[model samples]
Target: MTERTDRTVLLRGGNVYSPADPFATAMLVEGAHIAWVGSDGAAEAYAATADEVVDLNGALVTPAFVDAHAHATSAGLALTGLDLTGCPSLADALDRIAGAARTADGVLIGHGWDETGWPEGRPPTLAELDTAAGGAAAYLSRTDVHSALATTALRTLADGLAAQPGFDPDGPLSQDAHHAVRRAALAHLTAAQRRAAQQATLARAAELGIGALHECAGPAISSEEDLTELLALAAEGTGPEVFGYWGELGAVDTALRLGAVGAGGDLFADGALGSHTACLHAPYEDAGHTGAAYLTAAQIADHVAACTEAGLQAGFHAIGDAAVDAVVEGVRAAADRVGLPAVRALRHRVEHAEALDEESIAAFAELGLTASVQPAFDAAWGGPDGMYVQRLGAKRAAALNPYAALLRAGVPLAFGSDAPVTPLDPWGTVRAAAFHRTPEHRISVRAAFTAHTRGGWRALGRDADGVLVPGAVASYAVWAVEELVVQAPDSRVAGWSTDPRSGTPGLPDLTPGNPLPACLRTVVRGRTVHLA
Candidate 1:
């Protein structure tokens, strides 16, 4: 028999895109790992001694994108279930419902709509949609996936949903409750359906060049059963790398037992700016309500205290300024009671940080909190006559989405697309940061990439990735790039993927100077998982 050798493969002539240096040339991969990455001279040694060689013809190379925040299983499920993501207006939403109503034997269910996009800011009543759908039980979630607007027939079925603490039939559902119905409806899917969902979701992530995902599991949204399903899949060596976060209030330690370390998962310390439950310092301009608060200040303190005491890194979902303050005070109290060592280990976080003034941004830096934000929010909704415009008024909306402010104030920023709420495209996210609505707040592409990678990895307190140094795990994306679309320093440059196929529909004009290129391949832990 001929000699069988496990040997090296050299990838040469690629424009390197590393955090510290971008001009590095050539890399050597051996035995499912990166062996050498340096100048072209290093390649000869590999060429003389290695097993295989491939010339890149000067394409760009970088660490694979990591979606720091997303719901993996659910995202997969949504693609196969009912995608109302492209439905434009209320009329269009109802028309789609009418169509899906005829095909579905069970509940006519879908997600992804925004009342703000319609001239009428409220969803049509159940009766109105019921008439159109012939009472097939329709449920279409708002664009953010925070709330669902349902028809009478669907409401009846949702009411009868015998889940635990959620899925109430009395009124429309938001957040936790919204998740319950979604889960129940998904339960109707067969094994074939689930597998298809997982495949599509993973394929999309691969196309986006995502090597890893921060799986933010929530109490009502993702369950122990869900974790089991994912872990089983991973054991079989399938799917993108998943960094799971179990959103259990009291069972985080158990989560650690299941091989998940903390990164994020917080509550509606109040709700969202769209739902007008941001727990404002003052009331909403039009609604005249001070938003909403989930826990008492003391209760909030207890949560922080509990997490710190448990030695877990904490992250809270705070959007409105008041919610931000609540978390800040609670974090301070937890730090004081628990001591310095406890405080430093916490790395407490706020999910949205959407609507904040100067003082709040500084407080985040001062408190050592991470702004676990989704920059895509600004790119999509920060435009004129958008959600922020009507909710906060033009004057207030003008300065909204303060990514630049947070960075300038020394606050550590981490990027995530509360997935299912938004598409988990890391390239899109970097573009959003590079081409922010307010140019003054625009961050460089490197900084934005860091937020998505290293900053996220650091927040999780792991030395895992976001870098391509020796001993670092081999995780990266190979680009068949036409251009880098995250930056635009001048008018002569074009940034972002204007191609509708590159990202979710309705993507804003948010690019810096470099145009987006296609992700040819994505690999995790030395294994190729995604290929264009």
Candidate 2:
């Protein structure tokens, strides 16, 4: 976490990957911007003038990743506290929680437990959580963060929980009930603990080659004080650049006051699919009830109008078809009120536009909306027989995360991990989109990579960044790879051969079984944020 002081550096013998010149072999970093890029010989000439010269030994260098949607404080907590992402069964999850609770002195907080893959096909009940916590207050969030199970002690601490929607006193809580408990549970962490957790998450992101993170904060997700503190921490230059988005309805003043990039990010139109709260047009295959909808079309249109008039970016968290319909209708109405050109100029975004019909896709393109999608959602719950199929049946499931369709319709695609729901694996996210379970829905590896990189920067209105070129931001990552191959849509093996004439740089072999490239270093503004 040391601040890099070297003002000038020459990176030689590396394959520089950029859209303009994908095959360049060297780059010169002067202060906070890329000064030059060309051959190794050209870099060598300026070596004497540089403050430092580092040989890359033929490593692949590209723009560092920018995660468009993330919950900074929650991600940090999950990193430092008990993580049950790998627990195979409900029994194992409870056992791990019990172990953590035995040693933990205060409120026990844990995350990332998914029962969809478990044999039980159900989460631990409230009684089970109580047994695990041994009377201590505990709140364990499901992998999707849409729902959570709380011990009786914790529920007692949460005010008016029984009166809230999605309340089940002895079972999992969703919607407002979940939000209430989450807020109470997060209150247990002291300021120091929260700061340490945030640092830990950002450090991990740097190691994974991430240069920036968009913190999706809200009244329901995290307090204004927490968001203020996180923004202050990022301003100190200790971690990646943090773009704050306060998702509260009619909170433009709050956003501007806190120096937020937007007033909407994870401003829920609905919940997530895994929690059976994604506001589907039809009832879930597994459950009788259709999902919940937090915002009506009128409400969405109103918020968009307010944000647009105030010159702020407006967005929503919409996953299911019904929610998508609502969002599209809202955007259409906003366009009517503010004019299509004005609405499009704002470049409003929709987080997790996972389930969309042809009509919705057209609406996104016509309105010039940015789709901030998470490919890992498809990787985790997609496929022929994955959790999505179990909940939605075969016909509806196959339509999940239609990346190819979205791209073809001209919707701007920005990729992210939605971390703590899925770990922040940028490479894995690219692979998942390329090798999507529905073959016709898959995109090329290069296209997927661009969405994660350049598309993400564009989402935050950083058009000049997320690309490696002269005069661009000098934020990039170096990786050591075993082999290089460009992935083709039809066949993985067919793309193994290098083709310089293809006008594309060789990317890491990211077939399902191939190992991802090991990140050697991550540089932000010509400063080393992580070095291995």
Candidate 3:
């Protein structure tokens, strides 16, 4: 599985998106580092000496993307197992489950079922699920992964599961009850099955021009053994780089032992809005009570201070406004206790920071926290008639995922799909952020693209990677694009033209209806991992 990177390669006759030479049409890769980026005429000097020369044939070359937040095993399972992502109705979903159960050897695990849009306006009842699976053990996670429907057979696997909070004998499981059942269901997978699932996810990532992935694993979300195996597989040099984040309170030693870059990610401050579990200051419009709060500000402070002292990044999954407030409060307290500079230097993260306000945005910039956000959430659930409005009403819903405001307030952004909840489609992610339904919340395509690429590297304290420049890692993708142009949120700023004199590197035209670029090849550390 070892990939060779000893040869020098010259790539010429294409648009190169490199800040080092904005108008460059060629690049040189010497071993695992970028050596040069300049005009086509300048590339001739290296062409004679390079071990390999590739004719770009009017394509585009840019830094490969980094998915800042992901769950490998879950994504893989969704890819290989029964997926209910777009099931038209509860009956259709149940039919799919019934079909899966006839051939499923063990637990009939399935994911990505959303009941909001169903004509029934509800998830399958416990009896309905049992009937669908023919009374066999089954677990079907909701699209948001915050809640799930578990058959009686599956619930039996976890002793006293009914006693756990968020458990409902006749409805979907959430919180502790959901976590317990998910673990039991995952345990049914054989080691070989798990490995295959992880590999499948990685292969898909590479194919989509992804150079790296940040795996959000925890005791509640995934097992230590699962994270270890995934890291080992990635180390074999056959796929995108995997950076692990172990989400648990005071788990520094465990994180380091498991080769994790941080002790946080899915370290839940709260749940998600789709399940009506995201901690809100006010009660949900549909539900009578405020959503759940998994951690207090004090608890958050303790975790952040400990992680900062241990030299590990600390992050939390805070999707509700109240949850975001708690994170901001706790991180600020940690800065007070550990010295602001030390805490800020770690560049800690907050996963799925979908809810924010002016204060939280300012706090994030002050604390140097990376908002590991997923634009697909807004794309999927934010609008006049979407789930956010259903849960929080129009005014509050309009405030969710304010990327433009965040950027204005200086909060760093690292984009991801939070896959299994959203699919891993990098260009689609950028497009979603650029064309947000709330027009005021939209950002430039270039900014969104950078957040998916270099911003991810910056989040991990790898300042120089995720870009194409001299001395940077040669991790980039070759794309077959119809055209390249500079895009800005404001036409005046971009000059509304494709002029080389602008000195701004162009990306594929990402207009709403335009086709996305097709990946022709993907290279990581100067080694080709994918080719079309």
* Poorly placed runs, candidate 3 (over 4 Å): 489-496
lDDT of 2 at 304: 90
Candidate 1: how large is its RMSD? 5.7
> RMSD in Å for candidate 3, one decimal?
1.4
Give model 3's clash tally.
Answer: 0
Tens digit per residue, CA lDDT, model 2, 477-513: 9999876676554542345657777767888878889
User: How many Å off is the CA of 174 in candidate 3?
Assistant: 0.3
Q: Which residues of candidate 2, in runs, are more than 4 Å off?
A: 1-6, 489-494
Sliding window of 10 residues with minimal summed lDDT for model 2: 488-497
Rank list by TM-score: 3, 2, 1
State each candidate's clash count.
13, 0, 0
Best by lDDT: 3
Would you estimate the TM-scores of all the predictions?
A: 0.87, 0.98, 0.98
Name the lDDT value of residue 287 in candidate 1: 82
Error of 3 at 209 (Å): 0.3
Put down candidate 3 lDDT per residue, 1-532, tens digits, no spaces.
3456798999999999999989899999998899999989989998888898999999999999999999999999999999999999989998999999999988988899999999989988888889989989998899999999899999999888989999998999999999999999999889999999999999999999999999999999999999999999998887899999999988889999999999999899999999999999999999998899999999999999999998999999999989999999999999999999999999999998887888889889999999999999998999999999999999999998989888988888999989989999999999898888888888888899999999999999999998899999999999999878887556224334588887888887777798988988888888888888
Candidate 2 residue 456 Cα shift, in angstroms, is 0.8
